[model samples]
Target: MPDIVDDKSEQCIRFLLDCLDAHRKQHAGDDAPPPPFFLGLNGVQGSGKSTLVSLLKNKLESEPHNLSTAILSIDDFYLPHSAQQALAASHPQNPLVQHRGQPSTHDISLLKSTFNSLKTRHPVALPCYDKSAFAGQGDRTPETTWTRVNGPDQRSIDIIIFEGWCVGFRSLSAVQLESKWSAAVGANMKPAYAGRLGKLELESVTLVNEALRQYDEVTDMLDAFVLIDAEDTQYVYAWRLEQEAALRRERGSGMTDEQVVSFVNGYYPAYELYTEALRRGIFPGVEGRQLVFELGKDRRVKDVKKI
Candidate 1:
């Protein structure tokens, strides 16, 4: 594949094209073949996965091959707020469950079942998770999930780009907290659960680890993986803050900036772990990791590393 750093917009397009070609070659002999091409773009918040996928889609649309493509965001799989609230009610001390983007916050089984069905050319319904409301909305949910409809003349879906913050991490065994008080170290602590803080801490770690493991498993199902490395955690932190602010503003909410910061901070430890793991060569499957695209202080792509 072409280098992701040199003209990322173009390189991402070329990568998609190459993936499509590879998929065709891989199942050349099969008459009723299943969908074979899938790509996973894993990165932290504000790491440019969405932008890269958009560029790829535009590039493919302009091509002459008539290739059908779709971008599936893992964010859409987040559990509804009602479900999360139920979990929080039962495990009152575990703050991680209260946060929306953590591992346990998603409907993993549904995601797996949908992807599995899509792989076999079956239609699958995909839920649309709303980040602003921290829930799933009805109208936005995919009614007839994109399927690989094969025909002699019409082109089937040539590439499916699955991108998300925690796409490639796998779930580990659950880690139970020793006490609830220990869990209140992070922000967004409620007084009601202060007594069981130690238990919360253990549950939070367990939740974080399990989320990472689930991400890894999701990525494992992809044919290829890409990581958009930010300049540093600080860059991502700024971007996330801006995003959350914009979201609150658009929603016409009365939440103050401090509240937003606090909520965002609650996720810092979890995201930091993800960033550190990627930086430390913990994710071994990314083909060519590109760090710091043109978006921040040190915006130029600097290194080309293999995972």
Candidate 2:
């Protein structure tokens, strides 16, 4: 949340404001009631998704309008660490722990319910997930919980920004190269010293296919989709490392860099595959589709192409 104008986050905020302005103008003469705008912002880990949302909220709050806005992150829906630990124990040999950032780890029902309630202009309780503890903190809820203002003079919510690493990603079947089985075995074996483990591969592709269908439902509700295209997987990896380092320092865990890298590796394959699809134009969310910005390696606009 630094007030650095040069940062990509600042640019993202400006873009969102421009969109809101256009929306207001387009509906200026319409007698039809204006619907609440939902902006979906997606990016890879450490791609400034949360920072951009915070900046957008600040910008909106400063503007004089009855316009109420809320920012929701998919991270808030992460399964508690205890739930994750149970899964790991059940399938000790499986790489589900590494699947933390993947679609399989999110509670789709909770997300769908939250969105449904928000659309109705009702007060909705948003969950808060703790990153360090890998569980829900049960406090520190969203500042502007969705609520309908009373009276005919009440101003309606003009915008809602739903941002997350995989917000717009369509869940697909887990595609594991046969070559990766050996590597999976090696990684899963390390935890045997702590408890008995079972050898399980990635979740069946059918589950992934079903998850993608759920993602489709979420996207179908979006008014606009913004993708934060990372330069490459290497860039995302570096950003994640920096974040993890800061997190470990704050917790005083004294974890070595090697240990952190090893832990992060578990979630790397899924992220790499998903981002590769974006680069190759095969991403279901962006194949010849609209995008808010085409971000590049230098964190500058590489091109402003319409989706």
Candidate 3:
């Protein structure tokens, strides 16, 4: 968590602070403290989001800003090990539901309740998920170990940063789903763009799409959004490979290149299916609050668009 500000971090800080300024202006006359500004951040896996979050939080919590920021990851709201196993058991035939990477694997009720609690601006323990638990299958860390914030005695939270690979994903209608699926099926046959969506059954993808609808309950709460888009979604595989290679270098053991490919394959279908919808825009009728960073295969920003 070094307080380092690189070019990307500088751009993000500018966007986020502008958002904060707008939020404060909106509540200029209010007596009660403005509710914690909710910011939704979405990035493709292995896109350096975690590093960006750390840098952004540091900037907000120190020096001139001195804002109390609480970080929450959608990954922390994932189903516990037992629940995830049960999900896989129930949806034995649906490969998407058989793991924790897709929409249906999250604990939607818990997420909703957490958001509700944050809105109250009261003491709440942020949920934590241990991805290393149960030999990397993952589980929720115990409540006692979770971080507590916004208490009467503690610094009141001013901003809540909710980030995840699929934070602001919107659900699709049946027609849209079918159109995307059919197009992906055609694309999959060719070697030009190798993606995972066409390999999954339409019924399986539909189940995930329906589950995504539940996430809108949380998405609507976001006051602002940041989308870290990639020019090629397939770059995720190479990015993840580099991540695991670094992990193995430091930890002596980690997923191999083949396992990394398999793991990413599990989540690639959602990227293929929904990333376009996000690129088009997640917040319609509301402008100036959303920021999109289009990144090349090298993970450098190619363009910045404010929507």
Residue-by-residue lDDT tens digits, candidate 2, 1-307: 1121234555555556666676667678878655667888876666666766776777776655445777778887766565656655765555544345656667778788778766666556666765645232222234354333422565445578888876766544434333343455565678542211123344432344345567667777776667777655456656666766777778765447776565555555555335544444333453333354454554555655445
Q: How far is candidate 2 from the true structure (C-alpha RMSD, Å)?
A: 6.6
> Model 1 misses residue 56 by how many Å?
1.3
Instruction: Find the candidate with the highest lDDT and give its number.
Output: 3
The numbered model that scores best in TM-score is 3
- Model 3 lDDT per residue over 1-307, tens place: 1121235777777888898889888988998877789999999988888988888899989998898888999999999999999999988999987778799889999899888888888778888999999989899999999988877889888889999999999998999999999998988888885888988889999999999999998999998999888898888898888888988988899999999999999999889888988987788888888899887877878899999
- Per-residue lDDT, model 3, residue 283, is 85
* Arranged by TM-score, best first: 3, 1, 2
Model 3: how far residue 160 lies from native, Å = 0.7
Which residue window of length 10 is worst by lDDT in model 3? 1-10
**Native-vs-model 3 lDDT?**
0.88
The whole-model lDDT of each prediction reads 0.58, 0.58, 0.88
Each prediction's TM-score versus the true structure: 0.72, 0.69, 0.95
By lDDT, the better pick of 2 and 3 is 3
The alpha-carbon root-mean-square deviation between model 3 and the true structure, to one decimal in Å, is 2.1
lDDT of 1: 0.58
lDDT of 2 at 36: 69
